[model samples]
Target: MTKILLHGCCGKMGRVISELSKKYDNLSIVAGIDKFGSDNMGYPVFKSLDECNVEYDVLLDFSRADALENLLTFSLKKQKPIVLCSTGYTEDQLQLIENKSKELPIFRSANMSVGINLISMLLRKVAPVLKDNFDIEIIEEHHNQKVDAPSGTALLLADSIKNSLDTETEYVYGRSGSSKRDKNEIGIHAIRGGSIVGNHDVIFAGDGEVIKFTHNALSREVFAVGALKACQYISKVSENKLYNMEDVIGLDF
Candidate 1:
């Protein structure tokens, strides 16, 4: 069994991942770290990662940006692989993740949904081909408590689209009045509401037709499963490597 230390154990995402851990025979969650003193569905929750005595095979971070530094430091010190499911990292924080990836097996993704990652790959392929006549726009919806806008998935899709295009693509957040989109602009929109798990849409608008691809995640367990799969892959992969869902899923096209 691959032992894991799950951060943010008190949050909704963490809770779902914990429950899903029970369903996988090859995976076992050994310890949990949370800011709140709340126990994780019966596991002893530590107030900080520093207090944990047990050694785990991997660390799964679903915590906030503020907590990331500590987790990264811990992972580096322990020389363990890490799977990051948190979002809203600033440029400096991203640089840190990039730097950390140089020494440890790190899998960082904003959205852990396999479907969404596939959408990212698909967008890269479709964006450039459709760029001539189509205007691309991205829309993402999440739960009310979600703190990020445009979402990690939205940004991932945007970056994939940008990478595929020969020219640099500009990202335009929701527009104001009297504003028009440039041919090179990729519009990203965000919607937050109650109890929505996750939804992302990429639309290509043309003169006579519209092409759309959407991925809707109805349960947090889907992400948990993805994270688990990532952890499994991480165990076998070498250090100083960065990977994503595409790498884990082994999708070449």
Candidate 2:
């Protein structure tokens, strides 16, 4: 069995993973860490990682970015692999993750849905072919409670397209003043509303035709399933490196 240390056990994603994990015989949440402890959770929930005494093979983190430092510290000290599913990390924190990955296996992804990663792969292949003739735009929608604008998945898609192109391009987040849209600009727009699990649309517009790729997450289970997959992959891998959804899903980004 893959023993899991579930971080942010009280949060939405954490709770979803916890409940869904029960269906899998090979996965078990041995312990949980959350600032707000819950008495109802079948496993023990501690206020901090320092308080956790249970043995777990891997740590699955769905907490906020602010908790990353402590999480990384504990994981490194314990020599446990970690799957980071949090979003909205700053540049410095991201660099820290990369640096620490040299010591222990670390799995990180902006969006854990397998569908989203496949979309990223498709974008990388298609962007290079259409860059010269097509203008691209990305639209993402999430719940209002999400603190970060232009969900990380949006940026991931944009980066996939950006990296695939030979020429330089810029991201324009939600248009405004009368300046016409630039040819090399990739527009990204965000929509916030009630309880949207997640939605993304990538539009490639040419002179005659418009092509769009879309993915809609109806529930949180998609991410929970992906996180479990990552946890399983990281626990077995010996390499100490920063892995992403591409690595877990066996796809190249």
Q: Which one is best on TM-score?
A: 2
lDDT of 1 at 84: 92
Off by over 4 Å in 2: none
State which candidate has the highest lDDT: 2
Count of clashes in candidate 1: 0
Least lDDT summed over 10 consecutive residues: which range in candidate 2?
244-253
Local error of candidate 2 at 65, Å? 0.4
Clash pairs for candidate 2: none
Give lDDT: candidate 2, residue 102: 99
RMSD over all Cα atoms, model 2? 0.9
lDDT of 1 at 177: 77
- Candidate 1 similarity to native, TM-score: 0.96
Across 1-253, the per-residue lDDT of candidate 2 in tens digits comes to 9999999999999999999999999989998998889988899999989999999999999989998999899999999999999999999999999999999999999999999999999989999999889999999999989999899999999999999989999999999998899999999999999999999999999999999999999999999999999999999999999999998778544
